[model samples]
Target: MTGTTRYLPPGRLSRAINRVVAALTRRGLSLWGSRILSVAGRTTGIMRSTPVNVLAFDDEQYLVAARGNTQWVRNLRAVGRGKLAVGRREQWFTAVEVLDDTRLPVLRAYLRRWSWEVGAFFDGVTADASDDELRAAADKHPVFRIVPTSTPEDRG
Candidate 1:
């Protein structure tokens, strides 16, 4: 569970849930701090979007790829920026990857907040897992600090 290359593709249920979540966020609803994450596709250059949970910790926001190196994670790493949208509001931001060594706290906090939804991907790791355990699981999950570059703007 400590490899950056690991990725567990979404199952049918997961995919369906993502679509519903994205739709909800687009309609001005947030299901547990969810938002629509839009990023230019590394290959197509067209914006591809998916639903994501925004983790607020230590007064900063972070995006953690709990399912491992999924498409959106790879795209964000390649582009280094993207837009987060909730209904008509869009915020542009640049992302910086968090190194594996420093991910313990964020990983623990994120798990504490999202374990019900994303826990399977982390195997048996939990919010109360030892620092070493969480650290070992960190590399399998890519984390990015969201540095917003634009004020939230009205889409209209």
Candidate 2:
């Protein structure tokens, strides 16, 4: 995917909501497939956690940056791996950034699945939006394919 350096950051209200959802997912109460993503910070190496909407399309799992190039996206790019936690269960996985040209289908599926929550960030594009529209908006969103890693060292 293209660098989301110019994507908008989450506002205070959105941040607050994410915190709440994250807490719930961490406690194992998944809200509409939500999960708490934990990745090591690029600078501090401290584990940074955020609530994310995990999308399952076809037979693979994905993580989409609905809020654009946020901290987690940057951290994921740096670390190349992370964990998805729901309550007590955690799944370790390495991430591959999707190419810009391949993002439309994934973006469409994501919007279709979570539009009520993330549609606004797409500048009015909905799940029903045409491919051209979705393609036009693809660069603004960053998507990563999640590959399950058996062990922490497996990420390498």
Clash statistics: count for each candidate? 0, 1
After best superposition, candidate 2 residue 21: deviation in angstroms?
A: 0.8
Considering every candidate listed, which one attains the maximal TM-score? 2
Candidate 2 lDDT score at position 14: 87
Q: Candidate 1: TM-score?
A: 0.92
lDDT by residue (48-79, candidate 1, tens digit) is 99999999999999999999999999889888
Error of 1 at 14 (Å): 0.9
Candidate 2's displacement at residue 153, Å, is 1.7
- lDDT of all predictions, in order shown? 0.89, 0.88
**TM-scores, each model vs. reference:** 0.92, 0.93
Model 1 has an lDDT value of 0.89
